[model samples]
Target: MSAPTIVAADLPAPADPLAQVAIARAAFASGRTRPVAWRLRQLEGITRLVEEREAEIAAALSADLGRSAVEAWLADIASTKGEAEYARKRLRWWMRPRPQPLPLNQLPATAWIKYEPLGTVLIIGPWNYPVYLTLGPLVAAVAAGNAAVIKPSEITPATSALLARLIPEYLDPEAVTVVEGDGAVTQQLLAQGFDHVLFTGGTEIGRKILEGAAPTLTPVTLELGGKSPVVITADADLDIAARRIAWVKLMNSGQTCIAPDYVLVERSVRDAFVSKVVDTIRAFRQEEGTNGLRIVNERQFDRLASYLDATSGEVATGGVVDRDRLTITPAVVVDPDPDEPLMTDEIFGPILPVLTVDSVDDAIAFVNARPKPLAAYYFTKSRAVRKSLLDEISSGGVVVNHVAMHCLVPQLPFGGVGESGTGAYHGKWGFEALSHRKSVLSKPFAPDPQFVYPPYSATALKIMRKLF
Candidate 1:
């Protein structure tokens, strides 16, 4: 089936930047984003909207990237649905006022943490996993009770169009709206005075988003990508390590922000490890209905093709490019020079690089040299190695025996740190990001005697000493 067409004329059309802010502010001022019942309704609306439009969603995905329907369901739509359900079920518990204690000296007063919405929120989503990226933050915003304007990636036109058409039909424009355009529209939205802006994309764009938001002193949460590393220690299970890393690295055609960029295998088991990776990539071929990898669009296809360099590495397996399908066969590159273009940027495709090293310590050092990644993975039976990796390295998160599974746990905070980007979200963290944790303190109306007041005579000091 051919992809659906979204003519420039077909959309709600881009509104003036000022108008977007004006509408969002008005809705926010109305206090629509703060009610728990209202938030649950929005969540329910999103779920029904996505389910009712499943066919269009699948077709648009297939047309845009040739992704199989099953893959779309598993990789994209399911997560959004799950997040919506999770938030709706738990919002009451999450929105409950938290209690705090005053010291014995101040027992007469009471204090508790209050959560309040942070007016208008701006959400900028990435092309890879467009559906999940778009809706994930929206769920958080709705739960936190904030008006949001979501800008989907222009690179994936079909998904972007489907979202723009369907979202407003199910949601109130004043509370939740979809805005579309190129980088220009993105810049325009970022220029506004949003209470909070949550962006999920590449680090390069993450930086630009920061630059735009900085002037307003607006708080921003950046979910950026980096060279997420995986380490295989001497004592690790070779086959299990290979299969786990291979599967995650190829999921979404390696477009995941935290997919393993390269492997640092212990020299003693290096040969066996490479064999296992090769075996695992081959296993997917025999498995029925495997959406092994997908090439999202032409620009990315061209970008992946242009990255190969003869002097950089040795291709150990399939490296052919199927231009018609925009599919590149999974390939393993070994001993790639540290300075190769592959190492320089986030490789958002099905290419895995393996570098052998003497010790886990060496691998840790190599990863530390790069900017702090969004995630780091280590495979080992030894508790010492795992502890060292956890304590010594800095990342948004760490996985002990797998890659990219940190996103599954609803309790853990998800977001990059340092250059990979800063600010965290997911579960309670997400709610907090879209809301304010306002602190308050109260005292008795009755005036109390000040033991150390300016009547600092010797007799007054003796009485104050007893109070202390």
Candidate 2:
């Protein structure tokens, strides 16, 4: 059956930036969102939205991103539903305050941390993975009982418009608002002073977001991208490594932030690994019945094409570029110059570069020399090698024998360090990131002692110091 038509008129009407923030602030102030039942209901709403509107979401994603139905479900729809369900089951435990033991001198006082919402927050989402990244942060916001504003990326208009239409239908419209626009609109919303802001996009844009939020003193969480690298050791299962790396590298046409950007293989097995990867890509394309992967826009297409033009590496297989179609055959370049554009830039495309290293030490040194990545993947059966990679690499997250799986598990915190990005959010980490842990202390007046006052004798001072 064909999908229903979604015109511009069908989308939710855009709201003024000032009024959007004001309405969310009013909703938060009304105390309607503070209760656990309300928070859980919002989570349930999100799960229902993903469930009931599955086909519509897939259609929107296909319109905006040219994604297949299964890809859309795996990357955005299922991932989001999993996050909401995970948080919904354990939110009460996450919300409960834990008692803290007081010092000997303060025995009569009880201390604990109370989790509370940080008023209203803003979620500025990226073009890639629009549904998951945008609504993923919203799960945290509502889970912590804060009102929110969702700013979907303008680059993917269909997904943006679909989110604008569906969010209010599923969520509390008064507590959660969707404001659709470009970067300028995001800047205007930032000016309105939200309690917190979570942005998922590229690094340069993350810097711009930081600058925009600085004046308002608003806390921001950045889920930015970098050249996430994958290392293949001689001891690693060559076929398994090739398939895993190829699978994730081709996901969303390799636009994923945690997708393996480049491969660092041990020189002894570099040729075998590269050959297997090339064979895997061919098999995958043949299986999918597609000649090329889709690029989001002409600008991104031109940028990716330029990298291929300037690369000092051998284009091993599939360097075909069709600008008119905005699609590029998934190309595997063997041993590109380290300083070349393909090596230096975050290749947010189907282009994958394989660089050879002498040993695992060289691989570790090579990754460490550059800015920390959002994720680092090492494929090896050697526990020593795995431990070395885990111990030495300073990345947002690491996966052994797998690529980009860390982000899928809600138990792990997902965010970059150094230049990649800042702050983490998935499950409990997300809840705490959006919530303010207020410290509470209660004391009885009957235990008040004159010796604890401002004036003190020498003996009292000594006693106080000893007690403290």
- Candidate maximizing lDDT: 2
Instruction: Please report, in order, the local distance difference test score of every candidate based on alpha carbons.
Output: 0.82, 0.92
Q: In angstroms, how far off is 313's CA in candidate 1?
A: 2.2
Question: Could you tell me which residue pairs clash in candidate 2?
Answer: none
Q: Which candidate is the best by TM-score?
A: 2
Candidate 1 per-residue lDDT over residues 1-468, each given as its tens digit: 211221333335435656766777888898776777678878887777677788888888888766678878876787778777788888898888887887765657878778888888999989888888788889889889888888899888999999988887776656677788889888888888689999999988888999999988889999998989889998999888998998888777787898998899989998899988988898865663333356887778777876654427788876677677687878798878888778777888888888989987898899989899999999999998899999989999999998888886657889888988788887777888788988877778666667558868898789767655
Residue 412 of model 2: what lDDT?
94
lDDT by residue for model 2 over 141-163, one digit each (tens)? 99999999999999999999999
Model 1 TM-score relative to the real fold: 0.91
Count residue pairs with overlapping backbones in model 2: 0
